[model samples]
Target chain A: MIEQSINKEPIIATDNNGIVIDIRGLYKSFGAHNDVLKGVNITVNKGENLVVLGKSGSGKSVTIKCVVGLVAADKGEIKVFGTDITELDDKQLNAIRIRIGFLFQNAALYDSMTVRQNLAFPLKRHSKSLSPKQEEDAIKEALDNVGLAEAIDKMPAELSGGMRKRIGLARTLILKPEIILYDEPTTGLDTITSREISELILAIQKKNKTSSIIITHDMACAKLTADRIVILKDGIIEAEGSYEELEKSDNDWVRSFFI
Target chain B: MVISLKNIFNDAGNVTQFTARFFKEVLKPPYEIKEFIRQCYVIGYRSLPLVGITGFIMGLVLTLQSRPTLAEFGAESWLPGMVALSLIREIAPVITALICAGKISSGIGAELGSMKVTEQIDAMEVSAIDPYKYLVITRILATTLMVPLLVVFADGVGVLGGYAGININSDVNLLNYFSKVLESLDFIDIIPATIKTFFFGFFIGMIGCYKGYTAASGTESVGKAANSAVVAASLTIFVIDMLAVQLTDIFF
Candidate 1:
């Protein structure tokens, strides 16, 4: 089912470097004093799990949001699939957006809709050619991928935190996006649930062969899912390495994250 | 004081921009007919009982209260026609709109405000769905179409309540009372009254949606959205009513 879903997508050609996402000299400021992101540059390969670890208010989420064009940057360039998104109009931006999936911190499911409706919403919008039965199958397959087929009929209000996160992932996966952005995906879950979510992220990367930017402060999640990890501080990428290399780093500030 | 005044102007500018966007998006294709109908049901069908009851009481009390005053002039026979004129021309439309401003406006406000704070609006945007078209346009269109129908319904119900009120004082048959009401009403009276309700409805939906859609990120902002929706909608209704009446007077 996953393979069938993936097969129908129109693949986007990346440049020779296989860079799916590239940001350069990105600068965003909320107001006079609060500079959330300043001169930030990052790159995600075609199929890699790039984890971004940051303290609170370190512009981690803002950086990923800029890549998706959710939050506009005051200055700089954001290239998704080798196209700079800041220059695109709403129609063009939305065309780019459909190929990307976002998993918000709180799942952000439509409260008025059942889990089935939530998963079906994007599919119905972007893939209007699919028959009702095919849509149903897709919803079911996505739910099965997240291991929450039973919660299909439940409302977001009825689901627990972990279940809601899984349902969110299901909704994101239902679209068969080429790149998924996980914003604090495991933030409010218990340790076991966090690990479960982390494992799910890893499994998705392997099965879907998709690039991802997982914005999380959970070191456990980072250690588990990250193919390469970057620590964000003072509105920039302060350190970049594998989880073990970062743990054995000489910098006290970077090592503190390992502790 | 200077900052707060600036904030007010800022809010007004934002609302104006939002309203302009509504006009722009509402014309575009792929219209959300299903969501629009669902909103009509929720905003119109569900509020019937409340508007009906309020209309009934307003008509009945106005009839009963005006009886003594008319009797003092030995013009008690004018009660039915006078009450009909008042309810249809002014009372029913304004009162029904105010009730809706309270019920419908507050509901849309809180619903959208919660959606905003919880990132549902952002979710819709990231999913490549236009939240303005799906959420705001459907609601404003629903209210714009439904509020006038509700006011017409209120006019009918209020007249019925006036009949009941008249029966309490004297033995007046339904046929006689309705004849008097019909005699008192002109085609001109209904047209202006109904036209104004449409304005009332448009603003009610627009204000509620505007407040909720622009809500600050917090749980408390949800309550504030709901509260301010009612206030702004109610105020706008009266302002529109005053203008409508003035225009009607000058033209007719």
Candidate 2:
């Protein structure tokens, strides 16, 4: 049996005006017979940190992917910053993507590029207004933001796992995106490093007022960074509330995460 | 048999989707120009020696083996032209393409397929980076440009190898053999064969990237992508080669 703690009413805060992302009735399937996501819906508000918690195969990543138009949904609607993502052509999708930042699990730093180039890539692609010197300055500023200014010349392979994640974060910050999606940011890091990343994420949210949707199974990370938590089960939202509200819920799956 | 047919159809459908996605993504802006150049170096320059050696040896062995047979008919003098024409029109390009299909296609397929399986591709997408253009276009461009150059190198080396074999084993002088080769081989023969190599390159790169890019499920899918890339590329090369030959005969 599925837990039913998800509130039917949309939770809206007065301070956050614009809806950064809105998903409704999203469905995706790898094959004809097996559906990965089934009628999933969530809305993320501007400047809010929304953490999606789920088991490994419950389609939390797929939901975020649909919002970004990375994975095409079989049937659904995804609106990012009020633009319908699914209806957009490639050029339009790309134009919209410039304002979004994503930090991947493995960093996905181009193995061929140095750390500075890795950080500079998004800036070079998205921001033509910045001159070469300005780009370099922005790259340095991003690296400094993640405490990685010293490792700019090193290749990703040379960096440790934590360093790679930080560099990835640095790359994400260069775009100064209003919406940042973090996938498993603390999955493999030690507690101290995880907490450090959590602090960095919180600091970023506070400084930039950037809304974020972080997908992770790490409850500690969710508790630390989430302004609101959403739990996904079987391709649907199972529970959504603040950490305290989720902790107090009578649902076994929600309680299991805390225990 | 019925189940196997169904699987084959499913695979064909997947390949079609992959091709469609590739077209869709290639039109998008923010191209990765630097990554394309780096891939060109890896796919083209790095694989040159291997292709060259194999092409040369094929020509040399073919000349050596055919020498006695032609000699029996008092046709030893035909060795140079025969070998050169064969190398230019068929052996060199096809062999080089096959070798590249095995090396480059499998490499691209395995590399990207593994990345897909490990969720690296998904990560790139989330990062607002077009993984298709970054990974696929760079690779496709590399193969398209490099395979033709590799074929050229292979053709030159193969002809020289044939000349060398003939000079060493028989009374044919190097100058005479090369002159015969030069007289017999025309631009007509060389151009079409070389042109078809571009198509060969495109198919090899496209199929490899497609199979790898859309690879699904677990770790086994990476291996499957690599395998399918080689298989698909090889089959496509032969089909294109046959068509090229037919078209060349019809027009020229």
Candidate 3:
């Protein structure tokens, strides 16, 4: 376990190893009794797909939310891009947030807006200098990347679950974020759609060269997309390895997940 | 019982803080002018028919009910001025504001509550957009500007309804009826009532946005937020009206 930095200075990795996200001794609690995350540590390297596997209420979602500053950690050091993000204010945090994309389980599309408007929302807010035609082209290109170019003008309510997830990905990718955190990218989809979304995750990592931490119960998605996997048990990481290595583990609890 | 009381205090503090943040963000740059206009169209223009109908009914009913009392006093001729004064100085503002609390506040609460439940608000936050500025401030500003205008519309429509009601018993020409109504109203009557409606608008928007923005994580909380927004906003309108009335009485 890495020690919490007392000075909150940016940690320079000696080897210049591509560790984009380094979390140390993260703690979070809800109310009095619910100690959701305890001394959790995680790191995501450049261009890596790290899948987080945990049972319900194990704080998998909270872990990524902490990374993005959506959920405040009780105590920890979250170093993203060598800077300790836990110490950053809202303005500073938003700067870091702009480089990271978070995909919610439900896709989180603005229902009041059409797909075209939804895609344009973040773009118009963040990139004010882009011309109208450039903004339109970006929206079109993003939708095209998700293979949903034809669904541009449709409202979010008009889309299927799989299509919504894809459009969610399109919106996430619109700003060309370096890292994407996906929370159960295939939770509610069927077998075929789940595979499609998983494949898209893989395709996005390849195409965009983006590092991602995907939280999921879908082992198939894990096997297809994860370069490494971490399993959470009792609020801390219990095991960490590649898919096949953990699949054959002697620990009955970890191996049970495979069966 | 103790916990529920504590919860009430907690909610009051939260709502106050939320309103403070609203004032802070509303003055900042990158103003959402476009969304503000859209919200005005939704909260103001869309609300006209219901407000108009309620105002007309309120005026007609007040006039009809008060007729017997005026007749008994042999002051039937004082009907137009009495109805006009009541409608302008108290009834129109309070009733119109209450209707808006029911309609606009609850609508905002439900819309924003749904957005919260679905994580669309979080999506906006992660996109480096301030959800409070974009969603809360815009809606609050729209309501603040629009509710006063609605009250004014209601006052006018109600006076016309009084004209209709007055013609039922005796022949009063439109010009003469309006002349009497106009003679009854003064700057004191109109200004204070209008000022109070602005407060009514602010509280309605503030309470609704507060409830929705701070809703707990669940599908059920959306319904809870919407329900509570109406109750809270309605209560607040009465409280503000009472205070406004007292202030008006003391000063004027």
Candidate 4:
């Protein structure tokens, strides 16, 4: 599924070192439900694709949500870029989030804004001093990177499903984030389009040298982009290995995903 | 009934907390001035026609409805004074706010609710943008500032509407009607009314934003949010109006 793209490059730079995100003893629950993530522990080395694979309601997305501070863990230590985000206030959490990019399953483009405006939104918000020319160049480069330079003037509603995903990716990339969290990146697309998105995710991970946690049940996506994969079930990590390694596991449940 | 009462109280508490967050966020730096100006244009400028037409019709209808009753006492000559006082003191602000509560509040509620369910608001947060400041503060400020201005315009237009209504059956000139209107009005009548509308505008924006911002994660919740925004804001308008009248009576 990992088709060659024009922008493919090595994911790790010579300067990359140490852990970028380290989660320890993570636990969360909704209301009176049992723990969604019970004693969950994970780590992301610099510039590596760590895919979290789980069935629906297995708390895969919830785990990433906690790292980004979007969903607080009931008990956990989420250290992003060495700072324990669980202890940070909203202002500090925002500061950390500025370095992290999250793509929701829907792509979540601001429907009211044009593609250009959507791409430019974060730049305008975070970097108040950026001149108009700098803003224009950044927006154009982002769309160009996502192969949707022509759709810059169009609204989110006007774009096709694939194009919206591209635009959503472009909007995220415009900020040049250090880490990206993809929530079900290829959930509803056809096989070819899903493959294309998966490849783009690889291209992005390599080109930007970004550490990522790709959350998906899409075996093709996990197989294509994951340097390492973690299988989550029953509120904890069940297995962690490479694609080929996981495929040869003795457990039928884990092997079912490869099949 | 108890469940319904409990839900209402719960909702009220949520809205109060949301408003508190609004104040806290609004004070933070990077105030989103461009977005704020754009909201003023959308919530205030774009709503002029609806507010204008509705205000005109209200004044005309209220004057026409009250004419015969006053005429029975041979107080027909006092119609302009009475209508002007009523329009300035209560009718224009209250009516205009209710109209805005329908137009602007629902619009904000539905817009934000859609953004919420669709994850646009969350997208903003991850993009390092302050969603509360960008979405909530700009809107609440726009509504608070714009609604009073709209009411002032409506008051002026409603007076013209009263003249039109008065001329419908009788031979009252515009200038003469206005003179009577001006003679009937006092600073006491105009000041409190204008001031109270700021509260109306604030609550309208607040309830709408709060409902939309905190809407449950679903499609139906968007519609629920917009509908609830209108209901809650409209009810709050009446409550605030009653309080404003009482406070005015006691103080002025």
Clashing pairs in 1: none
Residue A253 lDDT, candidate 2, scale 0-100: 79
Question: Which pairs clash (backbone N, Cα, C closer than 3 Å) in model 2?
Answer: none
Candidate 3 achieves a global lDDT of: 0.91
Evaluated at residue B183, the lDDT of candidate 2 is 93
Off by over 4 Å in 2: A1-18, A25-41, A74-76, B1-3, B13-33, B127-129
Q: Residue by residue across A2-46, what tens digits does model 2's lDDT show?
A: 001111122122222478888889989987777888898889999
Quote the TM-score that chain A achieves in each candidate. Answer: 0.95, 0.92, 0.94, 0.92
Reference A-B contact fraction recovered by candidate 4:
0.84
TM-scores of the candidates are 0.98, 0.88, 0.96, 0.94
Ranking by TM-score: 1, 3, 4, 2
Top-TM-score candidate index: 1
By lDDT rank, best first, the candidates go: 1, 3, 4, 2
TM-score of chain B of 2: 0.93
Q: Model 3: what TM-score for its first chain?
A: 0.94
Clashing pairs in 3: none
Which residue pairs in candidate 4 have backbone atoms (N, alpha carbon, C) closer than 3 angstroms, thus clashing? none
Expressed as tens digits, the lDDT of each residue in B138-214 for candidate 2 is: 78978988899999999889988998788777677777878899999899999999999999998899989988988
Residue B247, model 1: Cα distance from true site in angstroms: 0.1
Model 1 interface CAPRI class: high
- Residue B134, candidate 1: C-alpha displacement in angstroms: 0.2
